[model samples]
Target: MAETVFATLTTELVHTRAWPSGHELETVVFSPIKGFCGPRRRHGRLGNVSPDAYEKTRHESLTHS
Candidate 1:
């Protein structure tokens, strides 16, 4: 598992989406200055998600619609 993950992580697969929770979910990594989508520039510039207002908005939108 580690080998596969490392291989995948090292590759150019940075930029994706996901569900609320799961292990077998597809993912993508981003850079600090690439995908800015929040009020504070710092929070929006992460390869990993921090699960804040943006996520809530997305989840609510998906669930309701």
Candidate 2:
């Protein structure tokens, strides 16, 4: 799992021009699980999220130019 995340980070770094913020995703992205085992940087930092709320956040980020 750690290797996969590092590989993804490497790939994203290689495409820094396309994703200047390095926050792009290739799938219907879900909010990082918000429980005890959530994402590292976002640990316990977000409120609960549903599919619709996640989509809305994604949409906002994608269009916040």
Candidate 3:
């Protein structure tokens, strides 16, 4: 799982030029069985995630810009 996440993030970073060097990239891994709604377990430090309400807005800005 970690390897896959690293590969995906690295690929995105290489392909996308818009993201700045200091930009924060977040990776969230949810259990296949429990999913997001299940018990909240913290394996490591949590990272920043865009608010659900504004997620679509943020995505649109990125794609359109």
lDDT of 2 at 8: 84
By the lDDT metric, which is better: model 1 or model 3?
A: 1
Supply the TM-score for candidate 1: 0.25
Ranking by TM-score: 3, 2, 1
Which pairs in model 2 have colliding backbones?
A: none
Q: Which digits, one per residue and each the tens of the lDDT, describe model 2 over residues 1-65?
A: 97998688667645554543434543212334333234333322345564455667889999995
lDDT of 2: 0.52
Model 1 per-residue lDDT tens digits across residues 18-42:
4454433332333332446443343
If scored against the real structure, what TM-score would every candidate get? Answer: 0.25, 0.26, 0.27
- Give the local distance difference test score of model 3: 0.49
| Better-scoring candidate (TM-score), 2 or 3 | 3
> Which digits, one per residue and each the tens of the lDDT, describe model 3 over residues 14-63?
46654344433322222432554333433332334424424556789999
Error of 3 at 25 (Å): 5.9
Q: Pick by TM-score: which candidate is best?
A: 3
RMSD, each candidate, Å?
13.5, 12.4, 14.8
